[model samples]
Target: MAVRKLEHVGIMVKDLDQSIPFYTEVVGLKHQYTMTHTNGIIRLAFLAGADAQESQLELVEGYEGELAVEGRTHHTAFTVDDVEAEFARIKQLGVPLRDTEITTLPNGARYFFFYGPDGEFLEMFQPAPGR
Candidate 1:
């Protein structure tokens, strides 16, 4: 048996229309598609980066529960080419940022945090060269 790769990360949201644009336009992901769950009460939207081989982000809406600051999922991170540039772009969008500035890890990786439309935690990660 083998696990090839992570399929996607599911994030609970309050609305699809708002979250879709945020993930697409703001986060730089493409809306692969949107569908309704078999239960008929829940709606789901799948998004991915320009590279289809990458894992996707599944946005679940219509769930009857509180979207706590700390939910079942901690946070969803996106791989970015330039952490500083992305941070500046997000800042210009007036999005609520969790980090005052980009952080550099011991391995030379960099990242920053921010909130989504539904108050979900999100991050932009840039790996060190050749990582």
Candidate 2:
């Protein structure tokens, strides 16, 4: 019940080498870091403005699907104090979920995907301490 703030918005990209620079240089955002998903498929890169504490942009690469030119957003994540709690609560409410279990990233952050009213991807994310 305590969704704190917007965590990040994920955008599907064909190449991180190209998207990373575009967001950092052209968009005037700072590249925070990059990491590969635990699934060993998707590559993720985060970017932020002057305030790293705020919401960020995530560039996702290695998706084996067609990327739409207009709507490239992959998912929208919201910061949660407890991802597990939220996941349970959402399930109890009968919300459609994309992930059966929470996914732990290399950085220790945990997240799970759920479907919104329109079938758009939404995430409940609990960031690792100090992140």
> Which clashing pairs does model 1 show?
none
User: Could you give candidate 1's per-residue lDDT for residues 1-131 as a string of tens digits?
Assistant: 12234556778888999999999999999998787765578887878889867778879888776655777454577777788888989999999999998877554767787999998778787755875
Q: The CA-based lDDT of model 1 is what?
A: 0.78
TM-score, predicted candidate 1 vs. hidden true structure: 0.53
* Per-residue error (Å), model 2, residue 73: 0.5
The TM-score measured for candidate 2 stands at 0.96
Weakest ten-residue segment in model 2 by summed lDDT: 63-72
Instruction: For model 1, give the 10-residue run with minimal summed lDDT.
Output: 1-10
RMSD to the hidden true structure, all candidates: 13.5, 1.0
Which candidate has the highest TM-score of all? Answer: 2
Q: Give a tens-digit lDDT track for model 2, residues 1-131.
A: 99889999999998999988889889999999999999899999999987788899999999776646887898999999999999999999999999999999999999999999998889999998787
Evaluated against the true structure, the overall lDDT of model 2 is 0.92
